[model samples]
Target: MAQFKPGERVEVSSNDRGFRGSWYAGTVVRREAKNTNRYVVEYDQLYEDGSGEKLLQETLDWIQLRPPPPPPEKKKVQFKFGDEVEAFYSDGWWEGAITGEHSGGKFAVFLQRL
Candidate 1:
């Protein structure tokens, strides 16, 4: 496992009694010492989204930290033209029909433009 860096997103243990379960998510605000595992995390309320208020900001060891999950993988588009697909778009996800395969994960989608 790589050393957690400041601004690195991670999950923090909420188990105050040192129980095996329970975790609260937060970002690594700062490193205590150079090349050390100490961190200061500003914790949020359990299950709180960005809109919710923060609960606690505390110093914890690296053992209490867990890396944030990897981003979701894009599904491979397997099409032979004229295939309907709900393709991801910059504006928003769109349901479009595949018109051509441009190779190497590229495809021409005839999107039903809004």
Candidate 2:
């Protein structure tokens, strides 16, 4: 029995050793006729040519697919404009200042070190 059904949005593993932790967005098409543990997926952005207009579809093992993550929860706003904050970027925390606030708990920060 497959955990996912047709038309469900999922993230497929890259399966490349160089990018082992990456996943690409795709939609489940159907389970393989001869293999229930495998599925056909249509990738969201992959293209068959350099024109970047066609989507690429491929068969993938169930172990390489996972349901998309849920939307992030909104956090209470704690800092106002001009407040100094530290943001994580490039594998390190960098000093920054909150410059603007956007909808959905997003903030526009200006990092002086960048």
Candidate 3:
């Protein structure tokens, strides 16, 4: 009965049994106009059965936004030879380990991290 915006996280209400026992945490992927407004959400939660691992395009009305949890404590990681870390690149976040070094010591390219 509430409006959901694209990319907003939402949970499937308990009454929505179609997706009740499966993955519920999802992001609103699209909105549709059926007799009533419907949302096509991309389910992000993993289910025990591997068969249900596809992006679920579920209706919007059945989903409700779950309040975001508090942010986790920030842990600063010192780059080391085999330390796993994520590198911020122009494209996106790349998971890797410290492999090579650069001039200032602050820059290092992760190798075989993912």
Put down candidate 1 lDDT per residue, 84-104, tens digits, no spaces: 765655422355788888868
Off by more than 4 A, model 2: 76-114
What's the candidate order when arranged by decreasing TM-score?
2, 1, 3
Query: What lDDT score is found at residue 63 in candidate 2?
Result: 93
Indicate which candidate wins on TM-score.
2
Cα-based lDDT for every prediction: 0.67, 0.77, 0.55
What's model 2's lDDT at 98?
Answer: 95
Q: How close is candidate 3 to the true structure, as a TM-score?
A: 0.40
lDDT of 2 by residue, 1-114 (tens): 447899999988656654444567789999888989999999887767779788889998999888877775797558799998756543233457899999988888876641
Residue 90 in model 2: lDDT = 38
- Displacement of residue 78 (Cα, Å) in model 3 is 34
Greater TM-score among 1 and 2 belongs to 2
For residues 12-56, write the lDDT of model 3, one tens digit per residue.
533443333222456777677663467777666544455866654
> Quick one: ranking by lDDT, best first?
2, 1, 3
> Model 1 scores what on Cα lDDT?
0.67
- For candidate 1, give the lDDT of residue 18: 34
User: Which has the higher lDDT value, candidate number 1 or candidate number 2?
Assistant: 2
- lDDT, residue 74, model 1: 100
Overlapping backbone residue pairs in candidate 2 total 0
